[model samples]
Target: MSDMANNDLEKYAKALDNAIMKYHGLKMEEVNDTMRHLWNKTYQGTDIDGIKIRSDVEGGASKRSYNYRVVMTKDQVEMDMRGRCSAGQKMLASIIIRLALSDSFGQNCGILALDEPTNALDVENIDALAESLVDIINERKNHSNFQLIIITHDENFLRKLGQAEVMEYYWRVSRDSRQKSVIERQRFR
Candidate 1:
């Protein structure tokens, strides 16, 4: 990786850590330490299963080439996410990544969306996710005009949101017996 690319990745990682710390009350370094534990595998190969990877060139006047993948020593580990993560973990990871990476691109991404966040989650995990979501929204509420759009069919998840003071809008979407969709929007404190 070139200096610029590495810098960008580090910036994103830092932003992710900071967001987790602010919203979840986690220390960035400690969260990084936890993620270190999560990465259990490492490799020093030019390609993944014989597929070639792009290389970066560097030198003063004459350029030299090196493979970005040809180095590994406990720096990071790959997350076999689909295989290892539970449904709720995957859901939460997706939301957290989306929120964190968005800031890496845009300064103030006003809107963050999640589709069917309660999908595949048990009742307990669903409530835990709702609590985390509440914390995230509360943390961002005072910063600027931010929005959290959660599209879920679970009535229990809605209930976990409690009254609506923390919510700017409560969108209740449903469908008739004919399968026609309807959307209703209401304001909340």
Candidate 2:
């Protein structure tokens, strides 16, 4: 189209990129701090201090795309998480990332849901996760609209989680003889 229009589009694109970069930078900082605090003993000899983002911006103006490589350090050794990490490590990292994302953007939505968060985690890691989630729940318990919904089949985990904040009951979902879904609220004693 016109040169003026092109220039305006370029400016808008740059602005968008700047906003995204700023948000990512802040989110990464939060992730780093949280990872440090939530490091689990089950993670083996490696302590994940933090994660750095290696991002490249490409393409023109409105068509720009950002390529990112999440660089994680294990015991001071730098490596890409996709390259080498156990299932439990990966799961914990995934949870940390989601928590960071929620902290960054969940204010507007005010709801966070976790499905099988304890899956693939060791006993120590499960305990750590339960404590971490309890801390989060306590932090958000005062918020009028904020809600954390956890879905899992681990009864022990539920008990561990409920010990801190009693919800009185939890919903049990099952199937009837006709295969219809049934949701019943069962109290925790």
Index of the highest-lDDT prediction? 2
Strongest candidate by TM-score: 2
> How does residue 117 of candidate 1 score in lDDT?
77
- What is the Cα-based lDDT of residue 162 in candidate 1? 58
Model 2 over residues 92-156: C-alpha lDDT tens digits? 77887677667766777879888998898889888878888877777888889888889999989
Q: Pairing residues by index, what is the TM-score of model 1?
A: 0.52
RMSD vs true structure, all candidates = 12.7, 3.6
Model 1 Cα lDDT, one tens digit per residue, 34-111: 322222221112222111112343553223344332111222444234355455555554554454444443446678
> Candidate 2, 58: how far from true, in Å?
3.6
Per candidate, the number of residue pairs that clash is: 0, 0
